[model samples]
Target: MDKRRTLTESALLLLVSLFVMISQGFAAQQVIYLLTAVFLMGIGFLLPKSVNWILILSTMPLCYWWPDIAYYLPPLLRILSMPTKRFEAATFFVYSATLLLLPLSAYQGIIVMLLAISLYLRQNDRAMTTLGQDFLASTDDHWEKQQQLALQNKQLLDSHETQLALQIAEERNRIARDIHDNVGHLLSRALLQIGALETINQEPVLEEPLAQLKQTVDTGMDHIRLSVHDLHADSLSFAEAFQNLLMIEHLCPVEIQGSLFTDLTDKQHNCLSMVIKEALTNTLKHSQATLLTFHFKTLPAFYRLQIRNNGIITNEQYPPKTGIGLQTIQQRIRLINGQVHIAQTDTHFQLTITIPKEPTK
Candidate 1:
């Protein structure tokens, strides 16, 4: 029950009573009826919380000296007397009073019936409001549960991915070991046999073919050794690998800035290692660079690698040839959907690579 609304209704009832007093044929009791109605309105507005007490006293006047607008009395009285918290036995007593005293006329009867209907509808409205609040509370609980499930699912997926990566690394290490222990030993024996046969006297024609065969076999063995090293490359930490590349003998001084975080996958680590190795090789072999600089940085959405050298003294008099090392760097970057840019000026050469931290599938 709204206090303001109840007060407004009480005030309106007083106004109706004033209109009724003016229409009534009797003059002696009109002033008394008007005064009673005004007094009740004032009580309703000023002490809305105590309106029920006023209601008990109010009914005496309505039954004793029925006002011209007595039709308004029963509804107003019923509203005030009814329990605000919940329905109670007191409601039936108010209902009985309303039925017994309500003005018996088609017009007044119809008005009384409408007032009852209005009260009934307002009760229904309050019930619906309570239900709506409960529904919203239930919806909030459901949304929280969904969020918890999503977080749990993500954790499970990350754990699975970590296990898969460990298994792959183990498998790669096993393969590298097998290749080194078995294939490497076999190649060494073949080389020893070839050397022993070389010392034996042979025709000049046979000697030439045997030397060519030995060269081919040595080249194949070198390729196999390189493959085995690559297979085990994933075991090396990024920092260790980068430092090893820097420690290699070079004509120029190498400077490093920033560092990479350890949240990268094995494939990313391997690719980055190869890029640094190839870039440094180019600097040592081709650039007469006196100073080499390597810069690494991680951003919110991307990781950047930059390598620059001030060794290329030659200005771009003509196009610089793109070598296999540079080509390999580009291919590795492409595999991760990264971008690589190269810049060469009269005194310096720079390679910049940027890879998104989370690559889109």
Candidate 2:
């Protein structure tokens, strides 16, 4: 495109020079006009966009020395200016050159107008091309940012799902341990006692019923063992489980202190797990908290768990109304013979639970 534009400008310069030579019919005057016009045109073409103003300045000499034919120079100057500046330059040249050339010939006035219009339109086209490139660049940047945000959201969701699954698996294992350790042990002991009773008995009538009872006890113990094995398929430490729960990004910062794990009855573990899950859910759904803390420890014959959060309390009054979730939590604690206390203030909510290391029969 640049090469074509150069060729076109050179051709126009040649045509204008030939016309001036024919019209003036003076060799010296023709040589002066031709050289001045060619020099200005060459400077305009050579200067980069950075030095376009120099090209504009070059036009003054043409206007002064060759006032009669100065209208030919503005079109040549248009080549050096950038797209955004082209329109203004074209307008200036048209008005300035017309003042000098308009009275000389009606033909000259028409030619100058035609050239100005062509320059203005070409500059406008260049401006549009530049604007289109900028628009495309902005759109591409926005698309890349959107893609990055979508990928982050997907990763967050995957992490949340993995944490919830781990919680479920841990709960299952605890259940299996409870059944095997409590029920299986009791049944096996009963079967042994029945066998000892059989050896002491001397009656044939008592032997049949004793054998039947032993078979039932043996079967129950076997089933309990199998179920316990199935439940123990996956086990996660308490510290790791807590870490996963805290992986939820938008939630407040969580701090877990004291012992993360210890030996506790299945019932106590289940109660504590339930409370933690419910507390986290409530915090996410209703509480606008900035910090949460969990403190777990062993106190003599009791296992103690304390949870506190710096979230807005729904009610200002003491002894707040109990929802079904809280009622459920209380009921679970009662079943394990544990003590639960929930307290709330304007800026904080707290839950404290204490269960016996060995749950009641």
Candidate 3:
């Protein structure tokens, strides 16, 4: 039931109780009885009991011309359990007035109280039923909201899993193509040099180009080894990457400041490491300024990387014709679904990168 409806219904019952109690009692004693009943009604509403409502409802007989067993007044015992409700309260009021008229003895008011309580119980039970239905409806709505959240979470997980699989495939293809082309061709060239060296044992001068060939072979081998390790690992922890980045502080005149990384997930560590490397390379290649500062902060789901260089972006060297460094950083960030921002002005150049918690494969 609407809250308004419940209120209105209780009001009507109160009005009925007042009128009946006033008219049926002794004319002279009516006011006293009515007042007493009103006070008792307050108690019933304030503290209704199962037995009390029942008594109040049944005791309406006391408002009649001859109140019966307005006699056995003291038997009902209900003060202990009454829970307050309005209708039952009014019923007790009228019952009290009617009981005053009976006054079988000084103690007759007790019987009327008992009967008043009984009737109040019946009315209270109806109100409680309506209240129970409202409670159940609210519970149902709460359960439905929880179910919707669970479904949305499931969909998001499924999408992430699909993207991860696609990215792994792409990485695999890239590694395959690089190894087959660069490493394969370099090794093949090295083999030809070995054949030439074996057949032509002429002069020591012929061996110079073969030594260069051997150096190329070693470099190719090193590149292949690093590539294979990276392909398998897919991640670098915070300590390793941050330590590698810090190596610059000792070697260059640049003064690096601010807190080092405390902790980061494997993927976050990798993304930040790449961004730092790219930013430092750009600073050296583009700007001739000396000082560099890196500030990193850990957020709930991502990391914020800021690199500031005190070098001014000169008009001639700002690379407006071609920003290859900027393009490379942008591509790397995009691969992981992260964002990179480059701001170069007369006074300073800032590179800020935000990498999300879950990167694209």
Candidate 4:
């Protein structure tokens, strides 16, 4: 699965085949040991990389069986075919030197070769296993660090969102303060002027325009009052936010219908709440008919929210600019690495949102 490992495996398999061909009775007596090493490394036409060093070490026994050492002891040099490349001279020297302590014969040379190769192979095997264990431990540590990073990143984003929400709330309160200080008093004065004009200025043309102006001022007053009435609800928990969604049918014809397929988390509530508000607003403003629906479902990697309006869309410019409630909703979802998609057809308008429940988080 890893690129480096794959390449190494490929290379090792080729090397094993070469080793088997070259080792075929080149050393007539050491053939059994060479075959055993090759079989272990390339078992399923898929050699595990962990056995590379073992394969190389298995060839060491064949060195002493080469033809170069026949003159030193003519009687014991019959094993001239153990196929290998490294330390042929060294193996002969060590084996020959050891053989000098006793009678030099073919049978005795075989025993000497076996003893030295077995020791090196066993030591190499143990060392390889220990290195593999160290590699596994390091991998586990890296995985834990990545998880910690993801959690810290999630917390930082939530903190950022809380700060932004506070700022927006402060801006709303400031707007309300401005209305109370300047616009509210100005409208009061305009209402008094309109009252005075009703008594004194009786021209019919002037009267209708003045009445229209008063009506216009009254409309502005109503808008200011609505802006002052903040509609935001800080979700205390997942249950409260979900309950608020269910309660939307009272304010509009919202068919709040769907099973929470996945368990919802606290971070998702911010996005979900904003989505509910947008759906309700869209229903009231663009979708002229009844029966709007909110559906939520769980996915392995994301929590999905689908809002469908059964009402036909009439407003030509249905999708508003990233300015009002929808912008706030979009921003909230993206903070948690979520996505939003809007769709509209002849009879249905849907807003689908997917918030990540897993990684790349």
Candidate 5:
């Protein structure tokens, strides 16, 4: 039961018991019964539910000894204040027995019964209110869980779609490579043979035919080259490719931040991928780093990549005297008209790269 409701019920019971004692005319015995009622009510409120049964049973002996029907009010009030239904049926039987066995006037018996009935109804109302609140709380929890599940399912579906797209791109690239290697080489060989025939031919009539055959082979080679280029370009999805790279096993934990929304040419994608790969490799091989991070950002005119590690680079490794890795990184950036900056301090090493949005001719 709620504390406020319990206090209210106890107060009402106390007031009613006092009124009944005064109406029946004050006596030493009446005063004692009132005092005892207050004491038992206090105990019922302060103690746990386990002690309630003992208090109720104690009331049985008091009722027989005192035989005043009004004395039963305190224990009945205690029963009404109880939150559990465990002792309800037994308590009702005990109260009914006491009411029937007591040799009291009909008026006293009726008043006691009416008060008990009213208190019982109030207890039922409080119980219903508590049950409704519990149901609402449970419903709220169920709804929140469903929302979380839906979000997780959406994320799962998006991941599957991205993987499927990557697989298709890979297959297309494979087909393009096969065509370029086999058919393109054969066409080139035929064109070369036709050129040699034209050079060695003494018959003037065969020269035009040889030139036309060489032209056809050259056209087929051009078509193969164009197709291969398209396949490679289509295969380079910067976001997906970068995510795949991040998934690779590394010595240190890597934190990735930022978003990829800018479109990149195939060359730009490959350049950035290689640069990132080399940087990661250097960090693993040279630095005693425990954590690595990659931050990517797209600016109005350029795409920026920042690779950082909480590791120190000694004087021997600072300028990179003999290593080809840093040199290759610099060379690749220059090819795409991008800038590279390397910074090292006592606590951290950072590599920043920025490539122009528009490719330079």
Candidate 6:
């Protein structure tokens, strides 16, 4: 039984017992009996569950056999609300004997039995209610813990992926540097040697072959340079690039929110980086902005970028008549089959970009 409900029931029973004693013309012994019943109830509610049956059995006979003290029986029986499974058979025998040996008439005995049954049912209901509340509280706690654990696991997985990507980028940069320093220098030296040999050869027949050799070395050097450039460009980290771009002095406070956990292709990264740089430059140069916001989101099939500022375009040249910057942004997005939306209101200017995962046409 819940402590508060047990206390409430016990207090109400005490009041009833006192009323009965007072109406019957208070006797010293009857007052003593009422006090003893209240004491036993307090102890029963406070004591451990294992020994509660002892208190229940002790108080029952006192209330049952004593004349005019039956008013205290309900409170004494409240102990039955607790689970006393081990002493179930013993309590059953005790109740049966007490009812059979009652000193009252048959009708009074029937009424008393009915009263006892009703009190047991009511207390049992209270017990069930208390049990249900506890179960709900425990279940809620379990669910909250499960949600927290799932969030932590996702964060851990994302961190691991980010670190792995960084490591791969670093390795690519190292390889690019090595190729530029060693293989590129060797190719350049080979081309120079072929040129020198061509200059010394005077025979007309050998001139054509030497020229072909020089062309082959030149082609090899060009291939190496292109390979090195591609490696360096592909290895650039979008996050680092964004941070570096934002490091420039700004007239307004910039708030960057949200992140894209999905991996982006090199072309997508370059496009976004360039678009953001242009937007920031325009905002700083043209608009009298107090706050700028950069927001990113990843959808099921697209990546979204939003650059918004709380600034008004007052100058006629703010969004130039030709709209060259906007056109360039559109062209870049079109290459990736993405969408760009530019909105200007009295209070704000917003640029929205949505890049689809798969090309449309």
The numbered model that scores best in TM-score is 5
lDDT at 74 for candidate 2? 43
Best lDDT among the predictions, by candidate number: 5
lDDT of each: 0.65, 0.65, 0.58, 0.55, 0.71, 0.70
Mark the regions of model 4 whose C-alpha exceeds 4 Å error after superposition. Answer: 1-110, 200-209, 230-361
lDDT of 1 by residue, 38-111 (tens): 56545544554444655655655664457353545533543453435354234434544554565544445444
lDDT of candidate 6 over 117-150, digit per residue (tens):
5366455656688799999999999999998898
TM-score, predicted candidate 3 vs. hidden true structure: 0.38
Compare candidates 3 and 5 on TM-score and give the better one. Answer: 5
Local accuracy of candidate 2 as per-residue lDDT tens digits, 116-138: 65466456556676788888899
lDDT of 5 by residue, 1-361 (tens): 5667667766766666577656767777777777777777777778777677787778777888887734446445543445455456557657666767776666456545655664575557568768989998999999999988985676556545434544565576678878888988888888888888988999999988888888888988898888887876445477777767776676688888898745776456666777787788788778888889888899989989899999765447456433456766776787678888878778888889999997521
**Per-residue alpha-carbon lDDT of model 4 for 1-361, expressed as tens digits?**
2334433543443344334334433655345544443343344224334443343344334334532222222112111212232333444455555444543344445545443443344334445656888899999999999988986676667557655874674455556667766987898789889978978996887988888989998898787666655422231455566666556554556565667533544345555665676667666776675676778787676788887776775676655433244555666677668887867677777778888785320
* Prediction 4 TM-score vs. true: 0.38
TM-score of every candidate: 0.46, 0.48, 0.38, 0.38, 0.49, 0.43
Off by over 4 Å in 3: 1-28, 46-49, 65-132, 135-148, 151-205, 234-361
The root-mean-square deviation over C-alpha atoms between each candidate and the true structure, in angstroms, is 16.9, 13.2, 16.2, 15.4, 14.9, 17.5
Candidate 3: tens digits of C-alpha lDDT, residues 96-183: 6666666455444445545464455445655676688878998999999997787566555644553574466456646755775777
